[model samples]
Target chain A: MTSASPILIIGSMAFDDLELPTGSAHNVVGGSATYSAFAASVFAPVRVVAVVGDDFPEEMLGTMRGRGIDVDGVERASGKTFRWAGRYDTDLIHRTTLDTQLNVFASFNPKLPELYRDTPFVLLGNNHPALQLDVLEQTRAPLFVVADTMNFWISGEPQILASMLRRIDTLVVNDEEARQLSGIYNIRRAARDILTRGPRRVIIKRGEHGALLFDEDGIFAAPGFPLEDVIDPTGAGDSFAGGLLGYLSNQQQISALSLRRAMLHATATASFCVEAVGTQRIATITREDVAQRVDQIRSLYEFGASTM
Target chain B: MTSASPILIIGSMAFDDLELPTGSAHNVVGGSATYSAFAASVFAPVRVVAVVGDDFPEEMLGTMRGRGIDVDGVERASGKTFRWAGRYDTDLIHRTTLDTQLNVFASFNPKLPELYRDTPFVLLGNNHPALQLDVLEQTRAPLFVVADTMNFWISGEPQILASMLRRIDTLVVNDEEARQLSGIYNIRRAARDILTRGPRRVIIKRGEHGALLFDEDGIFAAPGFPLEDVIDPTGAGDSFAGGLLGYLSNQQQISALSLRRAMLHATATASFCVEAVGTQRIATITREDVAQRVDQIRSLYEFGASTM
Candidate 1:
């Protein structure tokens, strides 16, 4: 377990304005790579490959470096960083995208450092499928490769997404995106159809309902922790992916048992991610906090079998 | 377990026209009591108290008698039976109510047989909350009483529904209805708020995501079986209620362990109910079939703990 390799993560680094029912935060440090790298750094060494702008704060990078995350792959351009604005509905499930400015990320091309090329565990964060594929070509054969996508890529870049899907070991997408990708409303059938495209496993993230892992072995339904207050849900999914890959990178083999444990850890991390705007809660959570939440999750769903 | 009391079920007996993506069935046997009784009869003796019209088929009554269900409490009126027409969307989750002809059921009153009044277990099937309260008044103090309601009653008869809620042992409602009833979007919070109203337990059913049991002790999440083909989802909720109350009636005492098993059986029964229109699959399913599906559900969610 201690001999696991560092995890390579590539995606956008942005400043986001989020409006939630409870409150709102503007120009906060938020991005898929930032959230995933922070979450994964808790379990294993992480190398983040993303582009930011001159406008991006220095303290954010310092925070990542302080957490032992390698920032050598992060590139700083002359313009403003990626920016996004969104608002969550009263239910906190439906979110509206107010605006999205790609900025420096619009023409960004990830150049994996020589050191990151040998990283055994790679997480291709939510980005253009073409860009994800480009990163895939740069990295050597890794122990595992997991790719995340959304409805935009599934609909806009179907061919490139399909090509990228064929090369990844795992595909992570939310339930709605899964339905859109497979053209099947039933999640069980949708996951099965996606597996035919290539990924050995498909993880469908159902925010409040929890996550489901579908593979050849079988299906695993993980329970989502019930939260009394969720301020913002900006980076929960990315955090989930980070926790999962981080835990798996530490394992010698990814067995069903291991994947289940990873799912729980992922669930715990994502729970914290939504507790505040951006990654405030997840950024400060100790391993002990995660362990306690995992224990709570176990108790929430555990039921002893009765002799019939 | 053998000394368990019979279950008293009170609701409507209707003819339904169901249109799903796969196919459609017209004037089929349907109703909360009909579905619940058939599902409950497998576990315990069921006494159904409902109203139907002259057009109601004699064979349907014979079918109940054939399954060992007591129908002496069923009242015969002069007009046509209650009829409902609904169409399921492609997702099979959102359903459109095309027509609802209450007919005889509009002014019907449930006059329980003297024998049924003494039944220890009772299920107040989905109907007018006022009617459910009326039945509650007629019955003696039962060991357990479970009431099922829908959004229609929650919106139309909030005061009566609230009044009825205070007298029941458990409340079974789908996720959307739970939110509407509690005026809270979070299912966990909604269930918690419901417990304050009266029922000791609240079961929030999330169609594809499964069900969650919220009580004073804690929450227990049960996974829903994944079905590739769902012909019609008309009676799934009522069938779920039937399976749960039926199993509980057979237990000496309803413990959390027993409740979880009951949920599993309910889930399995509901799974079969949607396989075809109305109660087609549920009517023919044996206890062995339910047992097998319960086992499958266990395996679907079973995950071994890893030493992290």
Candidate 2:
């Protein structure tokens, strides 16, 4: 892998129909690769490898290019774009999927560009295990590789996911996915169990509760930014992964301290993602906005030691 | 209030029967006051003011006394003690209360000892707001008064609880209680709404998710220790309050920094509380253990500023 290699991201690029407690949005541009790429572009150049239908907005592709993202790898398939419709409960924690239309995405195959093959940092966004594995196979020896997945893949393609898990440096999943993958309810235990199966580090994302990073060095817990209003939560997880991998790629090193700071940055980025529908907030946020929120998050957990 | 006054605690003294995923324990000494007193005693002298029945074991009182708790105000009634039986789900988060026998606690009233009436630091444990008010009236002007309540009191005695809320400097409640009291589902919104009503600060305890401390300065979030095993979560909230107020009483000052440190100590204390049923782990933990855990927790969230 070359030192100048970009951060390669592979996942679905689609549209989302969200029914939130406060409001609803229809056919908003949303997807794992889209959010992750935008989030990572804030820290490092991002190359997105995913399929979208011809119906996908040309302006969205131009937006990615404007954000310094490499959109050449994004394929324009002939059919309808993947679409998801979900409704959030009053608590904004539980979500019920109303419908999932995987049109062009149903028979998708990620085709990495020749330049993307030499990428030193890679983020495999939430997707099928086989697809993630294919991307990994195509990439050169990455300095760091982080993979995010959901309960669907963990339960549906257990063997394939396990195989993919063995090759990644980090695994990111929500609390429920961690529990389902590890067969343990306690997050600490779940994380520890997942670490044994593969990945050097496991991050258990608890939404507004924050995230926990478990590795051999020890556990680092990052507090989520306390937002006064969260209009939408769609794509928050993808954005978090984006920010994390983005920061790591920029640093080109992995340590407990770096991971801790990256988590805070990731959390700040995700906070912005939830402030509006889809990637509206993240898209408009500058580095200054992310830095200010990161500072706030750092202050939120910083406590001087007691002399006693 | 006398400068040397011990931290006064008023709540139930009961026998708890707990059914956990690992095992079961019957007739274990458990109560808000008992846990709080023991936890607070680790940092400051604690005076417990509550009524227990003759059926309550004398050795339990001796144990408190051995731990340096003042029990002169723990009146011995002539009936069975308050008893509670609960079972924890496998997740160790959702607990089902099977039985609650008020017994001697039903008609009882707190009568603070002469020495305790002048205590400067007071912790009003989970009890009826009316009874808590009575205790407050008996105490001569405490320098710092913190109160804890549950969903039951929030829903059952809204007016009395609101009156109590107006008097305390700090209010501690679980996520559900905060939501119920403020009529807001979002935690940050709930905490801000609660702060507007009364108390200078509001700490929303999110069980396994740790806690959020909201005040005029801003908010402080503490992460829960990642424990591989959590035997029973009973009395965790009370112990957290105990550790918090205990540290505050020892410091004899309330600032943002002090509150942050107190939250860490409180988190460590609660971590030990869940290691065993009822107050078993908390009753035996030394100050050194708490300090070491606090250091560990501090490290868990510590990260230096990023260069970029």
Consecutive 10-residue window with the lowest summed lDDT within model 1 chain B: B299-308
Candidate 1 local lDDT, B129-158, one digit each (tens): 989999999999998999999888999999
Q: How many clashes does each candidate structure show, in the order listed?
A: 0, 0
The deviation in Å at residue A156 for candidate 1 is: 2.4
- After best superposition, candidate 1 residue A285: deviation in angstroms? 1.3
TM-score of each model, paired residue for residue: 0.96, 0.96
Q: What C-alpha lDDT, on a 0 to 100 scale, does residue B291 get in candidate 1?
A: 89
Residue A52 accuracy (lDDT) in model 1:
96
Candidate 2 C-alpha lDDT tens digits along A19-117: 999888899999999999889888888899999998999999999998889999999999999999999998777899999999999999888889899
Model 2, B1-308: lDDT tens digits are 22333789998999999898988899999999999988988888889998899899889999999888989999999999999999989888898999999999998888887889889899999889999999999989889999999889989999999999999999999989888999988888899899988999999898888898998878888788888778888889999999998888777788888898899899999999998878878999988999899988877775645433
Chain A of model 1, TM-score against the native?
A: 0.97
Give candidate 1's whole-model lDDT. Answer: 0.88
Q: Candidate 1: where is the Cα deviation over 4 Å?
A: A1-4, A304-308, B1-4, B304-308
